[model samples]
Target: MDLIEELMQEITLNNFDVGSSTWVDVTYINNPHSFYVRPTSYRSFLKSMQAHGQKLEQQDLQLSMNIVYYSKTLKNFCRGLIYHVDTAKKNCTCDIYAIDYGCVEKSVSLKNMYSPLLEQGLPPLATHCQLANCEPKNGLWKDKEIDAMKCYIGTEKAKLIVKGKTCLKLIVELFNSCPDDIATMLALTGYSTLGYNENVFSRIPNFKQEKHYYTYPKIEPGNVLHVRTQSGKDLDNFYVAKVDEYYDYINNVNNLLAYSKQAQSLRPEDMKENKAISVFVPQFLRYERGIIQKITVSEEKALVQLVD
Candidate 1:
């Protein structure tokens, strides 16, 4: 590989120290401790991907070269950095890092890889990062906490305050105009607690600053609530909000009704033991016609044999 290719490889393989603040799009969040970010500066990678995809459609790329390959996976074609290869196998498979997406795809077939050009000189688009000065409450990240973290930053860009670097990930604080940074927010939410990372501990906003940040008043006794009155007579009227719970109940009923309707619609006459229907094969990510060989009515499950 040439100098640029070598440099790019080194940069991608190592975590780049970013001791500054920048705007980043949060790509993946496994937990508060681990996540991926695509900085605004790396937005050009998107254009490169677009052009590469067009070329892929034209069938104009080689099948394999240096460390990089255009890999086709269940998720579709993307630039990949080869992580592992088994040359001994008759039909070799490779483990590759999906550079733009920041995820490792394992056992990718050799046939699905294509040679990549070195001219792009683009390093991995996604930067691995961890929320600094925060530790999970139970010394582990659970699904509930992960879900909460996802809900907090759903599809939104955040201000990334990169504090330090680890071997694999950058230690950072991430937030988007809340009462506190994500690290503190996790602690406040009882999913995590503040750790003893001096780099971030000293930088954490004080209580005065936290109070200055906008937060809704807690719903408690003796809180004044204004309501529109018939004659504008009542100034202190309160109402408990149940809009979310009400909608959740309605949705549950609707889903139950829909499921019951579908189950009933699958009558013996409508769908016999050997009924033919279009089935979506998730494995191949496509639709195919199949014969229903067996149906477990109670379980709402079916054994479908593809017509082939």
Candidate 2:
């Protein structure tokens, strides 16, 4: 079948790969501590997932197995689109960004792309791209991905969980991964595509939405698959690693600035410094309030310092 037909099919462990941009239901887990360590019976888990996918379709939102049809028409020069569906509350949020961004429980100034009108015919799918001329071809895609790109275009990266270990391959699919179910795993809290890091996982606004580009492995008719959420500890570790990485980056920037200053002071023959193209570039120290001040600029690099 063509792409459109695939998106319209009932979601299942085989046909649709579904994940929450925020949280997965924990009602199935008996003990939270042994969350990742224990194996989940694949049979019961698949049944639960299938039920959720069907609920979303009945609500009128169309989900694609892969966003290829939408992304192909959207160009990266513009912003990306992100949509959050609170199935429990039956509410949705949409956002558009020209650069890196994440969403919270609140709303933004952009028009509400989530509409009650899409319940008819073919509904639109989410994408991180924009179509040219604010118009798209008559296809299975939604208008927000094409015409309403003045906001943001967003897509989640995914990961696969199988045999109690994440598949090592770059691209993962569900065990019964069909062309129709393009499941992208989105983590709602402090994590990235690398899985959860407990120390570094922060609840900061833009830092949410950890996309796992994974696929599921097929199971025997009677066998079970233990699919569970990442442990809380792993979530924090992700943040710990991130903060350490930032510190290293800051130190490297300081060293480069010092070298640039020294080279500029040397004699023309000794340093051969090109006045037309200064080596030092200006940058800022970003914080919760945003760019507080410019820390480095050309010859003023030595004046910048970040304190813990």
Candidate 3:
């Protein structure tokens, strides 16, 4: 059978086509209205990727870039496309785009690449979908909206009611145990605004899509000064401790900066109860863990409690 036809047949069997209401795992949420889903029983599509994937060597990176390859990104092998190759060094790494999840991994090593099978023509396993007839109030997504969706959709399976489809993505409404369903719950709680007429996830603006690389401190000898050690063993392990401290300090500062930036951009209306956030405590003089307990937009005040 033709590949597309076979794929459609499987999608129908899984009840993932339009007018099908099935339980799906809400995997990744790009925004309040945009998310990715995997049917509880995705079936043969996953099995084919796992059973037919073939590993490749460093010399095979160029040829593998043009086709779908299995990338061992940690534990599970992901079907991805290598978009760029870093060939300046002897051992090259590539930037890979995981089609199913709609995410990217940079500087991936050659060992992760796996050549595609000759007959591997199926759509991405994770279906790109969006909440039907719903959008954010300000025409943008915030951390709160994303957080709300995560809370509503927890680890349990979500109901995907496929209303229709666009040229690329499915127009759907996701529902949990909430009385109003995901869309109505968001709207009632003010996390999202209603009146969206079509599938808008594709047209919605993504938040902070730019990527930046940082220069990390090397742990090799003579790379950094201040070599103090109590014994030979301590001396040998000095670089490791130093590097760990360097990363810890960098991470802490970055966290503080990110929190401050997000906080500044937020209005009183954006604050929601039980929303996870980082706050600068005057007594501690550093960013500390906190959860918003109460929001009073009229008073421009929120009661936040620090938590472990």
Best-fitting candidate, scored by lDDT: 3
Clashes of 1: 1
As a TM-score, model 1 comes out at 0.49
| Candidate 2 deviant stretches above 4 angstroms | 1-10, 13-107, 110-114, 120-308
lDDT, residue 227, model 3: 24
How many steric overlaps does candidate 3 have? 0
Number of colliding residue pairs in each model = 1, 55, 0
lDDT of 1: 0.57
Candidate lDDT values, in order: 0.57, 0.23, 0.61
* Residue 199 CA displacement from its true place in model 1, Å: 8.1
lDDT (tens digit, per residue) of candidate 3 on 215-246: 35566865755321212355445322242343
Clashing pairs in 3: none
* Runs with alpha carbons beyond 4 Å of true place in candidate 3: 1-8, 12-17, 43-48, 51-55, 63-75, 116-119, 197-308
The TM-score measured for candidate 3 stands at 0.53
Which lDDT tens digits does candidate 1 get at residues 120-176? 534455666778888877768999989988887877779998776533466788888
lDDT ranking, high to low: 3, 1, 2
Model 2 over residues 96-153: C-alpha lDDT tens digits?
Answer: 2211111111232222332321122222111111111111123233433322221111
